[model samples]
Target: MTDDSAALWVNGSVARLQGMPDDERLLDTLRWRLGLKGTKEGCRTGDCGACTVLVDGKSTLSCLTLTREVEGGSVTTIDGASDDPELKRVSAAFTAAEALQCGYCTPGFVVALAGLLKERGRSAPVEELMDGLQGNLCRCTGYAAIARAVALAREDAP
Candidate 1:
């Protein structure tokens, strides 16, 4: 608990947050200090994908991520992805497909899908798409619609 270890900038914005004790959660800092609410804290223990966000372009659970570790890297949240046309399309497809129920975990799913779709491109196969989204769990509508939406968005792309 030193005065030097208070908070720092994340991505490009200044974040005034304090890391919890060794056992505490980082999700609190994200929600409170950074005002990045896109990463949800479904299961604080890291089982649920609800707290997922991007760390260096990889999807990770913000609940378990320490703010200190994030200072030197890029952390992209669902809110950050909204600017991407592909992500916007993914979001629209998810909405049109009705892939969400309570909407708690949709942010994680969308962020993960953004990474998957961007890296895999529109030519990816169904199996690859399924594998990419394997970690995102949706308790609402069947994942078929979600997957279909992603696939359709891919096909619709030039």
Candidate 2:
């Protein structure tokens, strides 16, 4: 009965998300079909980063990713980011600096920071860092503290 379903590979496990015709709503599947709840559901329109996850080693909006599109790709969540050194640094810095107030947008910022640190390296200027983090929005902190957290994280990056 389950043989005619597409398999989604996530967090080193393969699960078939049934009822999805074209993998279009995989994010909801991850929350509903699977038990991975770390990835939150925010703006379903992709405007918010609450549903952010790493697809193929890059930060992507889970709300926008189709389950079929990521058939063979590796999906990494906040739970998976703990092992990444750069992400660890960012997490620590965020905590130390109190970068998050409401914390709804923190995960997305961390994920974005990871991608930026990976692509731009550790020496990115503050301005560039600000630009890189523009996509992830935080309404509670006014962004100054978050920016400082990223700066400290970059310094702590090896």
Candidate 3:
């Protein structure tokens, strides 16, 4: 690490970025620099949840987050499901409920759900959990299975 470089904990590992720009977005860093393409870019603005990732165990819109702003924070992307227990549980529930179609929004939904469970606990009410995902929009599958997946994750999480 150099004086001009900063780092963040990504997927349970330290990711040191050299000569990073001040205005670089976390979404771009994760996708282009780190090659973690699982976090899709639905909208460059925060309106879409496709760029969601867990920063310090909280769901954040990476499109609106500056990479340098999250320096030293733990970032859990969907690609790191196996490295995070909550993410693993949520992902399993999503899979079992067959909540994905086209798959572009799956990562955001999973990460958002995992973050909600982490914030609200596994015992959080199903309605609250579902409501927390209001920012996440999916053009396919109609969210019935997604709702089921949320319940399953809440029930299955320990």
**Best by lDDT, which number?**
3
| Candidate-wise lDDT, in order | 0.71, 0.76, 0.91
Among residues 3 or more apart in sequence or in different chains, the pairs in candidate 1 whose N, CA or C atoms overlap within 3 Å are none
Q: Which tens-of-lDDT digit does each residue in 1-158 have in candidate 3?
A: 23366998999999999888888899999999899999999978888699999999999999999998899899999999998899999999999999988888999999999999999998888889989999999989559999989888978542
lDDT assessment of candidate 3: 0.91
Q: After superposition, how far is residue 26 of candidate 1 from its true place, in Å?
A: 3.7
Off by over 4 Å in 2: 1-5, 16-20
Cα lDDT of candidate 1 equals 0.71
* Candidate with better TM-score, 2 vs 3: 3
Flag the better candidate by lDDT, 1 or 2. 2
- In TM-score terms, candidate 1 sits at 0.79
RMSD of each: 2.8, 2.6, 2.0
Put down candidate 2 lDDT per residue, 29-118, tens digits, no spaces.
677778777777888888877787777768888898877778767777776667667667878888988888878788888878877877
Q: What is the lDDT of residue 116 in candidate 1?
A: 77
